[model samples]
Target: QKEVEQDPGPLSVPEGAIVSLNCTYSNSAFQYFMWYRQYSRKGPELLMYTYSSGNKEDGRFTAQVDKSSKYISLFIRDSQPSDSATYLCALELSGGGADGLTFGKGTHLIIQP
Candidate 1:
């Protein structure tokens, strides 16, 4: 099984809608969880990350991590057409090593006007 599993969705939503993205992992060693946003033909950018099991919000985005359940989620509030992109969830071991990072399949989000 993949280290991280995400529904690579062309999840379409209207402008100003709420969007949700999710991922699950089987690795018990993973302690750091991250959400990445990727535009076509470009590298993914780190959207947010959390080490604790809780929700962290930044503006219109919220990242939630549940270590016990080995699950992570990203929420977009008042989503916009410009928000259309591929969203990826990533994980890393507690050691903080770069090589331990693993990514999900990515979910493609389309925000329609």
Candidate 2:
């Protein structure tokens, strides 16, 4: 079973709003992070990935991690309607394997125009 917690929200926001998505995990071994964006009926597309406690930026998206607090966050700047989708937070142990990968239930987001 997954051990991550994320608010399963149909979180609504107007276009151009700044959106913040977060997740928390209890496992301290998790060192690799991934944030995915899933459209209505498509597979999740990896939005961000990181391996340390800091912030990583990609265009309008930012992914952050704080190991001490076991916290993960994804920030979307200048949010647009096309950003309406579900966001999934995933974590993995330090090794390069799939066995330790875990994911949160995901938060549904709606960017209203």
Candidate 3:
């Protein structure tokens, strides 16, 4: 299996709706979990990062990690058309160095009007 897998969803969601994006990993040594948002051809911007299993919230975004199940999720509470973009999940192994982040293909999300 791939180290990380995410649904490349062109998930069409109405504005103001909640959005959920998820990823699954096969490596247990991954200790850093991160979610990123990217628009068009721009590089992804880090939305949230969690060191281990637990939940981290920031504004309209919440990131949840479950090491036991090798799964991670990002929840967007207030969806908007401006929020339309691709969501990517990243992981860095325990012994990873400064540039060890591994990324998934990314899920395409669109918040319609």
Model 3, span 1-113: residue lDDT tens = 78899999899999999999999999888889999999998999999989979999999999999999999999999898999999999999864466679999899999999
**Clash-forming residue pairs, model 1:** none
Residue pairs in collision within model 3: none
Which segments of model 1 are wrong by more than 4 Å? none
Span of 10 residues, lowest total lDDT, candidate 1:
92-101
lDDT of 1: 0.91
Q: Model 2 segments beyond 4 Å from truth?
A: 98-100
Query: In candidate 2, what are the lDDT values of residues 1-113, reduced to their tens digit?
Result: 34799999989999999999999999888889999999989998999989999999999999999999999999999999999999999888875675656889999999999
User: What TM-score would each prediction reach against the true structure?
Assistant: 0.95, 0.94, 0.95
Question: What's the C-alpha lDDT at position 67 in model 3?
Answer: 93
lDDT, candidate 2, equals 0.92
Poorly placed runs, candidate 3 (over 4 Å): none
**Clashes found in each candidate (C-alpha, N, C closer than 3 A):** 0, 0, 0
Task: State the lDDT at 101 in candidate 1.
Answer: 72
Predictions in order: lDDT? 0.91, 0.92, 0.93
lDDT of 1 by residue, 27-113 (tens): 888888889999999999999988889999999999998888988999999999999999999888864575667899999999999
What local lDDT score does residue 44 receive in model 2, on the 0 to 100 scale?
87
